[model samples]
Target: MSLAGKVAIVTGSGRGLGLAYAQELAAQGASVIVNDVDAATAAEAVAAIEAAGGTASAVVAPVGPSATAKALVDAAFERYGRLDILVTNAGVLRDTVLWKMSDDDFDTVVDVHLRGTFTCVREAASRMREQGEGGRIICIGSPTGQRGNFGQTNYAAAKAGIVGMVRTWAMELKKAGITANAVIPVAATAMTATVPYFHAAVEAEAKGEAMPAFFRHDLGFGDAGDVAPLIAHLASDAAAGVTGQAIGVGGDRLQLWSHPEPVATAYREGGWDAAALSEEFDAIVGERLQSVGEKFPPLPEELQPPQA
Candidate 1:
């Protein structure tokens, strides 16, 4: 995936997964723009890349804000004179159940994850369209967004919203040769470590304590570097035709999932009366609700602890 002469912008590249993506892309010959909320860390990452014989520049801006996102894109164009790839990886985790979750918490998560992604993609898509050459937009997503998790209503909602954005953007930009997609990654990072339940599960396993069956299986706890390869590929010219898809990258596994399932159901040729409509709607809703419990069975005793 040599990106020689190409310019790439990676948000939250100060450390962890974003840093890994920046380094890998730079190594493949892309002039990388490292964007991060922390000026110091951003500078350090850029300096490190330069020291390693890679081309990079640091752009310090909080990506959650629209103005800042525009600034980050402008900084990339100012430095490199072109924008080829935009990776919206900057995000924060505010874990809380729906009942306990605060408005601020919900807003913050949506602002950073969903709104931030939208701002960057909006700006980048405009530039890419103007450039008249194809471009790539990659949004970082999570499994919790696909399969709901306890105590992460806000996070899950934001992530799920990202997938919707990807699909819509992909369709909207297809004619312009711009591709929009998402990468759902399961890696060990500061955000995951901050969740008490996740931290305790890892610790318990390390100490040889009794653990859940799910924990016993390899849960794809790889280093941040593990996630960079897939992102690099998606951002490359080789994947130009792939868009509007959600791909999962965890450890050595890379898989794609269908967003919605189709099923056979009753239909009415003509408009039905209120009473008939009600009966049909109830049956459809009931069938769907019952399938949920059947598909996702109850957790085992060890894994059924109270969520944080």
Candidate 2:
């Protein structure tokens, strides 16, 4: 789908998955506004796009505060005169078990990922609504958020909240014909390179070797570029009918995730109390109880990182 004449803002586009999304949107003929906290990397990203004959401008600032969000939107309008698509991809990881996680760790992750998305979407939505031509809002989520990840309490909460917000926005903005969706992506990037599970793949990539097929197909882990196409698709006109969805992509896999829905429901004549729940709760919803957390297959011997 050609995004020709479209204007997009991709946060944290200085590197990693954000950079990939920005590049792909630009390649598809959109004028991209690249946002990042690091000026040097932001400049590099803009230069890379220009070098590839794509239009891009950089807005160097951290996302979260309304000011920064507004700055990104302003930059887009100032450079491209209008906004059409927004990818809320800027994020940071503060992984820690709940008890060990500090308030700062929790707030930092929530602020950047959850609040940042909210602020940015709020600003972009205002402009799109005023423009009266509809728009696209693509939020970034994670497997940790979809299920639960050990030692990633904060990140999970933020990502899950983002999906929730997207659902709400879809309903609220439907009248304006705007689409809001969340994309859950898994890939090897700066974030995953240090994890033991991806060391072998990361090493192969660093050495200019292809990643093992098993990792890409089975584990749904691949380079950041592997996830970019989905973002572009969601930002295109073809996806106008697709909104309020939590879609997953990575490697060779593309998945449609189900929204939260009750699998079982029980009612009482006079509202069952907790004591009643003790007696009949399991029988009512026990079998329907869903599992939590991501499940991974055992790593093959050859894929294991070499023992240090």
Candidate 3:
């Protein structure tokens, strides 16, 4: 996991998981650019990395839109001379049920998570293509989007969209020797603290108790640091062969999610009418649609955030 001579940019690196990622990459011999909307925290983060014998600079800008995206890449080039590993970890959360969710909430989350990710990816890809040394693109994803979560219609849509971007970019960028992947982390961080179960776990930790199993994931046992090493592994040359994957990392656990694909299909001499389609729908696909959570054993209910 030695990223010697590599230049990396980690958005939202002022604190939490992003801060952990920046420090680890720097420790592994990469020059890092710590990006965050907060000037103080971003500067503080850079200072910490530099104090630890690593090279880093702070860029205070909200992630999203082409201009801010360009600024991030520009900072990397100006300070480090090149960019190699880009971790799109900048985001904001606006959680609410669809009916109660405000337009501002929906727009802001999508702006930060979906559009912001694309803007950064677009700029990074353009430069990586010209640099010709190949690079790594690691995007942040969430289980909420993978399995769906209540009161997260907007967040879920954004995260699911991220996986799609990672897959598409992996295919398109591999020709340039670049790899794209998404990492889903189950760790205790400010963003997740908004969710009840994770917040409860955070509280328990404050009391000097172990995180409860109901809200646990392998390798991600309520520690933001748990997510850092995996990011390092993905960004390093050793993981060049791994691409277009959706991987989960947390408290002593690492797992790959199955890509969605057709499990069943049906055909007829001609397209079936509504009447025929209704009669045959269950016969054709009901088995594939059977509930796995209840029948095959669902994940522990604690994985879900407690109802508001």
Candidate 4:
């Protein structure tokens, strides 16, 4: 993964997972463009990279806007003469239930995550196409989008939209030699620590308590450094042939996920009327509700049963 001649731009690289990715990419010999909304933070990241014997520069611009995304991409080419990798990792959280969530809260999350990723990817893809060279586009997603969570309807929708974007872009951009992919990362970062349930879940896992199977896949409390390797690999030339994929990176778990499944339906020669449709819906709902009674599989011999 030596990216000696490549130029990588990572948005929101001032801190957290974005910073970690930028640092690791730089360490691997890529000249990095550290973009963040905060000028001081971006400058700090640039200074740190330079101090570590890596080439980097700061670009203080909000990446949520299309104009800002184009400017950021232009700045990278202006400084380094080329852009090889674009990591759309900049995002913000505005968590609230549907009823309590304001228009501003919902709009902010969608604008930052979904629209922002679109802006960056669209701009970078154009440049990559013009240059006639292959490039990588990686969007950061979350488990909340894969499996719904309380107080995160807006966040989940925005994150899930990334998967759709990646899939469509991979198809449209494949001919142009641009690879599009999404990484759903669960790491213990500033965002996760703010949620009490997430914090407790992580503590319970560390204490070796009998936790739910879902919690075993919880990525909310893992080290930020743990996520960079996957991003680096995806950004490298080695992963050129991989596209239109959604990868999950969590503690002791790295897996691929599929989209929602469609239910099977009985079809007739003539389409059913409204009354027949209603009857079918009722039967389907009743069968699904009844299926909840199925018991879990037995645990291994060494493990004791969970106490109620």
Candidate 5:
């Protein structure tokens, strides 16, 4: 969709997936306000967009605080005169098993990913409501958020909370025509590059070689750019009817995730006590218990890293 004359904001757009999202939005003719804590990379992102003949401005600030959120929205209005889309892509990973995860690790991830999405969406939605025009609020999520992941208690919790907020905002902002959705993206970035499972593919990509098809198709892993088109589409007028949904995207995969709902039901006369319910609980509802955590297929021999 062409976003001509539209003004958008992408948080943490300095590099990786955030930068890709900002660039894609600009490429579609949207004037983008790029937010990042690092001034140097933020300027570089703006320069890259301008070099490609797209409109963009940089806002160098951390994304958790209300002040930063306000600054980003203000920049959009001041630089482009209107706000239409917001991509909450700022995040951090302080991964550790539940027992080893420190309070700071938990709070830090929550502050940036969860609280940042909250503050930014709240500000943007408020202005969009006042402007009396429909808008788009796209939040970032992770597969870990949908299903538990090892050593990702903080990241998973924050990302999951973001999706929860998006669902809530979809209902609250419907009357004003503001649509809210979460994008669960998988790609080879600085983050995933550290994962042992992805090392071979990531190394191949760093050497300027194309990633294996297995990564793109089976694992749904590719470059960061692979996930940006979904963001652009969600931001467009065409997606007005698509809200309160968690969408997954990657190399060649596009997924529509199901919301949590009761998969089984049972009735008891006068509400049976705990002992009786415990006896029958598994027999009735446990058969349909859903699996948790992400399931990756077996890796091919050709894609494996060579033995040293």
Candidate 6:
């Protein structure tokens, strides 16, 4: 997936998945603008790309539906004189059950993930229109939004909202040659380390200690580099026609998710009264409903503590 002569802006690219995306794109010949809230990380990412014989610059700004979002797009133009790809990858995790989640937590997640995506897209789309060249717009999403996850109400809702926005952008920008798509990634990064067990394992590995049993199976899929190929492909001319869809990516797996639609319905001649619904509810809708959440499998007994 050669991106020769192209320029890209990848938000939150100072580290982890975002860094992988930026580096891969640059490695394929695209000049990159690395965006991150942390100045040091952003600079380090840029240095890494330069060391790999690629062109890059860093932007340290607060991520949100604010000037910072537009600044990312502007920085891309400043560095390369054109912007051809925009990846809204900046985000933060605020995990907790809905009942225990605070209003601030929910708002903070939405502000960074959803609103940030919108503002960045808004600026990039406008510039792409002015340049009269279609561009690639990729939004980073999460599976939590597709199949509900425990303790991720805010993050899930924000990711789901990103898909909706990208769908609309795809339709509206098709004639202009723009493609908008979402990637639901599963990679181990600082964000996922918020889970204590995952963090402990990362620390142990850093010190060359024996790892937990699950580290070779479920946890082995933590490499952020595994996600770069799909991102690079999507940002290339090869995927010009693939838009308005959510694609799942992790390890060696790639999945295309179905868009929402009416799977089953019942029509009542008089628009069903409460009594009629009481009689037909199960037959009409309840019976067709699928499972709505995800669950983690239990660890093997040997991986657990000794019996009390």
Clashes counted in candidate 6 amount to 0
lDDT of 2: 0.93
Per-residue lDDT over 150-224 for candidate 4, one digit per residue giving the tens place of the 0 to 100 score: 788888899889998999999999998889999988776777656554545445545755434444444323555
Q: What's the lDDT for all of these models?
A: 0.83, 0.93, 0.87, 0.82, 0.93, 0.85
Worst 10 residues of 2 by lDDT: 188-197
What is the per-residue lDDT of model 6 for residues 1-308, given as tens digits with 9 covering 90 to 100?
Answer: 68999999999999888999999999999999998888888899999999999999998997895698778888878878999999999999888898999999999999999999999999999999888989999999988888888888899899999999999999999999999999988766776555544554556546766556474445444457768989999999999889999998765567799999888977989898999999999988887898777555566655543344
How much is 106 displaced in model 2, in angstroms? 1.1
Candidate 5 C-alpha lDDT tens digits along 258-304 = 99999998888889899988799999878799999989887787767
Q: Could you tell me which 10 consecutive residues in candidate 1 have the lowest summed lDDT?
A: 290-299
**Residue 35 displacement (Å), model 5:** 0.7
Q: 112-211, model 1: which lDDT tens digit per residue?
A: 9999999989998998999999899999998878887778888888899999999999999999999999998876666666645455455554575644
Task: Count backbone clashes in candidate 5.
Answer: 0
Q: Which stretches in model 4 have alpha-carbon errors above 4 Å?
A: 198-221, 282-308
| lDDT at residue 21 of model 1 (Cα atoms) | 91
Pairs that collide in candidate 4 are 186-219, 188-222
Looking at model 1, the pairs that clash are none
Model 6, C-alpha of 61: deviation from truth (Å): 0.4
RMSD of each: 4.3, 1.3, 3.4, 5.1, 1.1, 3.0
- Which tens-of-lDDT digit does each residue in 183-294 have in candidate 2? 9998887778888888888998899888899888998888889999999999999999999999999888889999988899888999999999999999999899899997
Off by over 4 Å in 6: 194-220, 296-308
In model 5, what are the clashing residue pairs, if there are any? Answer: none
Model 6 alpha-carbon miss at residue 26, Å: 0.6
- TM-score of each candidate? 0.83, 0.97, 0.89, 0.85, 0.97, 0.89
Could you tell me which 10 consecutive residues in candidate 5 have the lowest summed lDDT? 299-308
Scanning candidate 6 in windows of ten residues, the lowest lDDT window is 213-222
For each of the candidates, give the backbone clash count.
Answer: 0, 0, 8, 2, 0, 0
List candidate 3 stretches off by more than 4 Å. 194-196, 207-221, 290-308
